[model samples]
Target: MRKLIAAGAAAVALAAPAGAEFASDPAQHLMRIERDALETVSRDRLQRLMRAAAEADEDVVRVSYDGDWLAGQAAPDGGAEWKCLSEALYFEARGESVRGQFAVAEVILNRVESSVFPDTVCGVIEQGTGELYQCQFTYTCDGAAETIHEPEAWAQVGKVARAMIDGAPRALTDGATHYHTKHVSPRWAGVYPRTATIGVHHFYRKPVRVSSN
Candidate 1:
């Protein structure tokens, strides 16, 4: 009986670690394994959760633009560009609504398409002249070091940025070139078509006319 009890105790001890490992959050466990394996986890998993949060469903893990809040958040190195853009948007327009943030991204992409601006987002954002706001984004020229203070906002923004970069349809903006909060309307609104009103901001697109010769 003593030998049998000892064998049972040994088995329990061996099984404890495996049970603990299995009890861990599946998403987190997979993430850790992926990180150790150098495998890239799809950003979609986080993006879907973010979209749900944006729609006011907060049961999902709360993310923010502040780096401090994300100290123990998910994989840090996942999607660098997405993280960069998200941090930029957080610092630039955290006060604005989600739609406003998307509009800001649209404007950056629009500049990429225009002949007057650089071809890439980083290029367009960083393009500027000395002592002047020559760049497409004022933040890049305003001499403010891009830093994330709100982790939840940054995480959500990271999801949005990742979705946008991955060719998720830009259906909300309708190719909008500009947007502003409903509290104030820009003069250019009169010349453009109002495409969408999301959150506090109204999105406008440049009207395209088909010429008849």
Candidate 2:
């Protein structure tokens, strides 16, 4: 703190014009210098505080289902993990509502957290590749080219994926790691405990197996 005050005092002294005078009296000159130094110190402290706040805010991804909030966010692009998540949302849940899209993203992230699924976003999404009807996500095994034809929808879902990847709360899905569209009742859906029904998808979490002695 003393160093900071000394630095502040030096800065204020150096910032003054070449011919500027604080006061004729030595006492008053010292008083003016001290006041200016204190003000500079306060401003410097405030700037540091503001920068810390901004950095903390950047770490938190506010969970909001509002379309306006998502649309207002800048276009997001990231590494392979982010791209895989964005593509998953684009192909699997682009048509879903903003809340639904977030829900789907939550499921993917929840899978990453689960011991049963792969730990990474890309790994989780591509768990079963190159095998028709054997992949976890149908789009990967469907054999059809994963072409992104709709830029607007892609952008929207990309925002959702980015938020989820940035640690948005997965409250909508209740820690669900599996989801299937309502039109199809997969064999696993019958056994997994249904946690959430959002938009056209049914979200589920695998039941915990109790080990008996």
Candidate 3:
């Protein structure tokens, strides 16, 4: 805090005019100028801080079903893990509602937190990749190209993935570590307890920890 204040003060002082009046009361004149500089910097800094707070408050909002909130965010530029999460959302749940997309992110993240799954998003999502039809996520080994054709949709889910990675709440999934689309009923779904039903997917978390391969 002190560093910020000092930097703000220095910036205000440096930006001020170099010329000074030759006053008879030189000491008082210098003191007054310093006081004015301090006041100006403090006021400007406070206003900037307040505006930043307001903007940040607006940036993160409820993930709406219509995807209205996504327009406010850019596609996240992150590492491989981020890309993996975004891709999973793109192939698996991009057409889902915004809430549904976030719910999927939540399930992936929840699995990361579980002892039964890999400790990272990519590790969990791409598990069982070498064995066809054995992958945790179908997109990884379904023999189809993992190409992303929808740039806008990718950007939206990228924002969702980044938000989830940055500690966004997982309220929708209810601690689910597994989910499958409504079209297919995997045998595992019957074994695991249902936690949520978001959009076209049914979510579940295993009743007990299972060994991760």
Candidate 4:
């Protein structure tokens, strides 16, 4: 299974688009600051910081590749692929078991399909109100210090992130958008339909009721 997963990841890397836009531009440097601030501060504050970073570093906007300036764009950033996936795993699952970490990623993707959120993985993860506490994932809003001292676990999570980003079918959570540890039951869990249980986490999906008259 591990070999298959690794092979699949490599294939996706090879198949990734070669367009320069898919390549990481300096503007994405702003995301690095945003992600860091999200881990330790409020999302609204992070947005303000991002704007400041962009304005303070006019060179970031003037960064040109060959002769063209790269702005308001996104790229695969294969060089940073491992780092990106590793950070996602750490922030999203540093508290969960291994399987539970992957499950969290699954739920994030599921929200992409629903009408309630944006249609991209990063979008879903970062969507939030002005307040730090209002977001899809609590980690993004929580003011906890982000650190990864466990190298082994980080490697495993990196593998999972690579797989999911590479288009591995989300076979675990089954379109779940909400989940919580077994320690407590949130009020919404009682109303939503239980989907799947992976590791210590309980997954849920919005309920759809069908009535027969």
Task: Give the per-residue lDDT digits (tens) of candidate 3, residues 1-213.
Answer: 657655655555555566644233344454576799999999999999999999988766545445666777666878988999999999999999889999899888988988878998899999999778889899899899899899988898999988877667678878888899899999998899998898899999878755798
Residue 67's lDDT within candidate 4 is 11
Model 1 vs. true fold: TM: 0.51
Full-model lDDT, candidate 1:
0.62
Runs of candidate 4 with Cα error greater than 4 angstroms are 1-85, 95-97, 208-213
Residue-level lDDT of model 2, residues 1-213, one tens digit each, is 757765655665666666657422334455576789999999999999999999999888787698999978889989999999999999999989999999999888888988888999999999989899799888999999999999999999888888888788888989898899888988999899999999999999988778897
The Cα local distance difference test for each model comes to 0.62, 0.87, 0.83, 0.65
lDDT, candidate 4, 1-213, per-residue tens? 657655555555455577634234423433454478787678678889999998877533221221122122233234454464556667767567656776777787677777777876667666783467786567667866557888756666666665566565576777888988898888999998898997778999976556787
Q: Please give each candidate's TM-score.
A: 0.51, 0.72, 0.68, 0.53
Top candidate, metric lDDT:
2
Query: For candidate 3, which ten residues in a row score worst on lDDT?
Result: 20-29
RMSD of each: 17.3, 8.3, 10.6, 26.5
Model 4, residue 14: C-alpha shift (Å): 59
Cα shift from native, residue 115, model 4 (Å): 2.2
- Per residue, candidate 1 scores C-alpha lDDT tens digits across 121-149 of 66665677345566545666677666667
Per-residue error at 115 for model 2, in Å?
1.0
Segments of candidate 3 deviating more than 4 angstroms: 1-66, 209-213
